[model samples]
Target chain A: MDLLRFITAGSVDDGKSTLIGRLLYDSKSILADQLAALEKQSKNKEDGEIDLALLTDGLRAEREQGITIDVAYKYFSTPRRKFIIADAPGHIQYTRNMVTGASNASLIIILVDARNGVVEQTRRHSIIASLLNIPHVVVAINKMDLVDYSQDRYNNIVIDYAEIARTLGLKDVTYLPISALKGDNIVEKSTSIPWYEGPALLELLETVQLEKDIDLERGRLGVQYVIRPQSNDLDLHDYRGYAGKIASGIYRKGDKITVLPAGLTSRIKTIEVGGKEVDEAFAPQSVVVQLEDDIDISRGDLLVNGDHLPQVEQEFEVLLCWMDTKTLAAGNKYLVQLGSRTVRGLVKEIEYKVDVNTLERQPAPAQVGLNDIVKATIRTATPLPFDRYTDLSVGGGVILIDETSYVTVGACMVQ
Target chain B: MSKEHNYQLDYLDQLESEAIHILREVAGQFERPALLFSGGKDSITLVHLALKAFRPGKFPFPLVHIDTGHNFPEALDFRDALADSIGEKLIVRKVEDTIQKRQLTEPGGKFASRNALQTFTLLDTIEEFGFDACIGGARRDEEKARAKERIFSVRDEFGGWDPKRQRPELWNIYNGRIRKGENVRAFPISNWTELDIWNYIRREKIDLPSIYFSHDREVIDFEGQWVAVSPFIRLDATDVVETRRVRYRTVGDMTCTAAVESSASGIDDIIREITATRTSERGETRIDDKVSEAAMEDRKKNGYF
Candidate 1:
């Protein structure tokens, strides 16, 4: 079976944790001991009913506050696919946590309360899904039981969200109506909503098309580390290999390649995956490639097919997400790490900050604080090969680390 | 999609590649790194991945083990043999020596566990070598607190983990940058579950310690779980020691780690047993975590790996 990584975003009032708990419970992923523990904790509730939301609130503070503070990863598998859920908090202040969770997700499940259809929280989450370039979107309208399982309510919500989808330029959006608390339209088709003809949430998750997400056209590999035995043995003497995971596309033995920044050309002599020689290697596969000629390739160097080379420049524009408590201003210097390369970078200028809730480009702020997303220009000390975040996320996403504190302060997506 | 263009990988391959990538990041970023080895199935799987990651070349870091002295003889024997077979450097530090030097008080109970004291020796070892990063076999599916941990979890100089201060880990990029005195605990297999590890082991044909398989042992029943009767625990007169065919699901200090009654003698049987089991890996085997709901989280905040 294959794997699917997704994120669930909704505020505490929208039943985000309840949806995840229901997914695990209905899929039989929760064991007997875990259920017993949940039952014990549910006694403290006012209603004396089992609170499934207790499953994802792992931290003590989160349990006390009855809210998700940070992103917690949960795992479950079915016959066809293995699922990794990044359950992130949806409060306004927790936008950074949501971005961190949505960065690696191929799909996103945005929960919208049926009582309040297409509210501000829903728009904010959709904006993030678009910013991170999530391929699939599942807008689960939760709490249909409260709405009396009315088909008209579901249709109105879908119509309201279609406008937001268009304004944000979100593609491949899917809508579903369900009651996460009452177990309606989750694992099994609900008899209550007979007018709805769509499959259950579990079936849609299993059958989502993800193979097209992997780009096999432009092969890219960033050299993470070089392996050299340098031993005196006759068979092992003078062996060197460039080791990294293919950022995108496919590579084969005898293929002509070029090392970026230096623009050195060579032919692939051999390809090894898991220490075994393979004829060809594709995207996302970690392999060791040996060049026919001895070239001075080191870490931070990019290798790509000779035909399609990424842009190598020292200056670029990016949408920066400030993550640290310290404010960021123009002329601030930090370490920018893109893929395997880390270089000195300066925030040249802050053009404008995008209002997440309204999707409007506001005036440039003098200083950007935590959870602020801004469009800015950055200049690196050395030329680096990179693609746009919209085109190839693996090569374009970067993180900024503080010089003295050594903390990751910002996440930048190349525009 | 075309027939020859079937570029999809099995779940195992995807997990393996991701792990190797993280391992390589540690090698590329840290000036001095070490792999925390405990002679368990998870760490053994890590060793296998390390071999695949840096074969035909020596590993960038040595294998370090903080011996709690309360370990089973079988696991210690296997630890020595595995390091010897790989022809790599293995550094062993004893918690017994730390307790003696520091004059620390040991917990007194029927099951006196040294699991908590392993952190002191680990911190001392880190200081002695100035290791900038230590790769472990911790998986998120094992516990709730671990599920929120990052792949490159940054620790303070005293080796404390602050969950709220975790760096934003995006895509496959990991930030291994830390201050001089601080170190990172890198978990390459953070995404792998217990079932994933077993399936990977079965596919790779990786050899493990004999305790992982079924064998006849004298065990004591504690709170509906089977605890091995070893010299580390206090045996009372009222306690009944019976011979039962059992195997360990997790390897830790002999006093804290429990065993399950099973007849799974091979990898296939163990996989089948785990598939049909109702309890989690930690729920079934780890007795130390039953102290409270946030037991693991509390320990992790105080520098317990």
Candidate 2:
């Protein structure tokens, strides 16, 4: 079985927690002791109907206020695959949390209440999903039982979302109708919605084609550490291995490679994955590579196949998401970290901010506040090798860190 | 190499790769780091992963253990033996020494657990060594509060965790940058579940202490749980101690970590039993977590691992 990481985005009243709870409940992932605790807590509430939302509200303040503040991760597995759910809060102020959750998700489930067909919150979530370039999208029209499982309502909502998807250029979009409160169309097919001919939510999650999502032609590896064992043994005198995770594509023994920024050339002498020597290694695999030529390589240096070298420049454009409380302005200096490299960077200019609700580009703002997405130009102190975020997320995504406070302040997708 | 080769990794492989990446980050970012080892299955699995992560070269960080003095003898022996066999540095700091040196009052109860006192010794060790990061084996699947924590959790000078002030972690890029006197608690295996750990251990053929397997031991019944009859706990007049075949699901201070009645003698049997069990790992074994609803959360806020 493989693993799939996903995120669920919706408003507080859209039954996002209930849907997650139902999926875990129907899949038998909730154990007896946990259920007993939930039952006991449910009794203290007014509804007293085994509030599944209690399972995801982890923080004490969240439980008291009946709102999710930060991103909470949930896990469940089936015979075919295992899943990691990033249950992020759905509030205008909490967009940073959603962006943080969506940064690593392979798929996204945007919940739309059947009673309210299409709203600004739905549009905002779709825009964020589009901005993050999530590989798959599932528009779950929830609360169908409350609407008497009306096929027409589902169709209308799907039609509305299709227009938004087209505007945002979302790919691999899927639609489904379900009632989380009544456990319909979650783990198993809902007999009530016979007109909707699609696999259940769990089935789609299990069988989603994720193999094609990986870019195998452009291999990239950022050297995080160098493994050198200068031991007294006969075979360990002069071993220098560049250690890193294959960001994309594959590396084989004897393959011609280049160390970026420095522009040094070398041939792959050997590849080892998990300490076991292998002939070839692919993306997402943490491996150690030895070069035939002795080169000065260290952390923050990029290694790639010579044929598919990334852009090497000192300045680039990025879509920056402000996550810090302090406003982001032009000429602000911060540490820009891409892959394993950290360099001093300056925000040269802010072109405009994208209205998350409507995909329109607003005029350049004097200052960018928290949760604002803006297109900006950044100039690094040193040249770096990177790919466009739309092409290779692992190599292109960068985080801006506050130099004095030592906090991550912004997330930038290299343009 | 063929261009059409299948590139999909197994679930365990993916988890392993992710963990290795995190470990390498710790090695690359922190100036002074240490791996928190407790000789439990989780920490043991972490040691195994560290081997895979830094083999052919010495581990950049040492294996550090916070000895609670209430630990089982079997686990302590195993911890020393494993460290010795691997030829790694092991630094041990005792909570007993901290309690005596600091003149702290111990909790009074039938099961007087030193689990909370562990934080004091751990913080003291961090200060003593000037460690900028502590790599732990905490998994999000173990508790609700842990589920909300980030892979690179930052703590103040007092070792306090403020949930509201947590920085947003995006993508695989972790910000290990911290001010002086502040340290980060990095969890490499934050996403693995209990069953996943067992499956990985079985596939990797890792060795464990004999206490993980079924054995005859003297245990006392306490609130529908089985507590081992060790010198750390007080025996009452009504308390009856009996011999029962049991195995531990989690390994902690013997005064607090309970045992479950089981006859599973091998990893396969243990995996099968865990698959069929209804109770959660901490719910079945950890007596300390039963104190209140936000037990783990409160402990984490005050700097408990």
Candidate 3:
């Protein structure tokens, strides 16, 4: 079965949690014991009915405070596909959580309450998803139940979101009217809305193609370890292979490759998985590849096919999301870890801050505080082999680390 | 070169690859490392990934189990069997030994659990072995506080976790650095959820303890958790026990681990149950965590995995 990772982003009252609860419940994906526990807890609540929001609100603090503080993951599957849904927080302060959730997802589902149309958080999440290059976006105009399943209400949200999607350069945007609370247009087609013609949310999730979501042609590999068996026997002596997961692309025997950092060149001699030799390996596969030359390859170095080289540079511009309370100032040094390599970097300049609501950019202020979005230039101590964030999602992102405390202060999408 | 293997790789294969990459980084970045094997499905999964990470040779580090001295007998046997099969060194440190040595105190009463007590033994073992990196099979989805933990989480010299001071783990280039007496707990399966663990166990065909499958065992319904009838358990006047077909969602201390009544006898059945369960695996199995809102966060702050 195919795997599809998607992120759900919405405001507190937009019924994001209810949608997930209904999806799991309607599909019979929920266990009896869990439902029993929820029912028991719901009985104690003021509503005296099963609060579907209690399903994704796993933390006691979240249930007590009625807010999601961190990203909560929910798993469910139909016959065609298995999904890992990142239930990210919709509050502006929790925007970092949204980025973290959508960072590895193939698709993003932005829930817009049909009654509210397109709100600010909706635009903010859509922008981040686009900035993160989430391949597909499904704007589920939720709470059609509140709007009496009105086609006009859903159409308004679609039109409002379309303008924002165009400004964000988002492709493959699909709109659907859904009622996560009452289970309309969620698992199966809604019989109440005769004017709608689109497939149900679950059906779209099952059939949406993800062939181009991930890069499979760059053939990039980051060496994680060098393995050598200790034996004096002549036949087995000096057997060394560099092992790692293919971060992107594919490789085969006799494929010309270059090792990064040292820039050494070699040809792939063999690829082995569990002592058995294979002729080829590709992205995300854990295999040990032996090279013809005994190059000085070690951890922290990347191996890529020789013909296609990522940009090697010391300075690059990034669309950064400042996560920590401390403000970002010029001349501040942070550890930038990209792929397997970590280098000291200095913030050289702040280009501008982004206005999430109006889809506009403003002049850079003196500092970028927590939850602030800005474009900045950072210079690394050593050159890094990277692709523009737009070109390669895997190679272009960097996490800023505070040197004194070693805390990840911010995340940057390299431009 | 041999002909292309052309083997069909599944989602588990991708997850395993990511884990192996993380494991190799730990091996390379740290001066001393150890794998925290609990003989449970998740930790065992980590061991399998480590074996594949450094194949054609023995493991680069020893496997350590912070034994609570209350584990299922079958799980302990399985742990030993796995170590022997892989030709890797196994280090077992028991909480009972710590209590007997007066290094730690045990909670009194039949309902008491040694779940929190394991932290002392784990920290002691890390110091005794001088291990800088302790790799575990903890997944973020298992608990709320864990969900906030960084994959390469840093612990202070006292083996306490300061959530506010956590290192930022971005991408796969994990930084494993610390001052003297400080250590890092590396969770390779941080992304894998409960269902992923079951699916991986099925896909790899890895052997697990018999208790994971349905079997007739004496159990008592205690405070919404299924307590197995054991010598350590204290049967209250009101508590009644009977034999039931049950399986463990999580393997923990005997005093704390709970079993669920189910007729699911195999991995496939367990996977199906896991898929359908709304309550978290820990919610049903972990008695220690049910005590408070910050139960996990509090324990993790004190260096418990």
Docking class of 1: high
DockQ of 1: 0.83
Task: Give the DockQ (C-alpha) for candidate 2.
Answer: 0.88
Docking class of 3: acceptable
Tell me the DockQ of each model, to 2 decimals.
0.83, 0.88, 0.47
- The 10-residue segment of model 1 chain B with minimum total lDDT is B1-10
Root-mean-square deviation of candidate 3: 3.1
Model 1 steric clash total: 0
Off by over 4 Å in 2: A43-48, B1-4
Root-mean-square deviation (CA) per prediction: 1.2, 1.1, 3.1
List runs of model 1 lying over 4 Å from the truth.
A43-48, B1-3
Residue B155 displacement in candidate 3 (angstroms): 3.4
Task: State the weakest 10-residue window (summed lDDT) of model 3 chain A.
Answer: A40-49
For candidate 1, lDDT tens digit of each residue in A257-371? 9998899999999999999999899988999999999989999899997476888999999999999999999999999999999999999999999999998999989999999
TM-score of chain B of each: 0.98, 0.99, 0.95
Candidate 3 — which residues are off by over 4 angstroms? A43-48, A233-235, B1-9, B144-148, B161-182, B213-228, B235-249, B259-280, B283-294
Docking category for candidate 2? high
**Candidate 3 overall Cα lDDT vs. reference?**
0.82
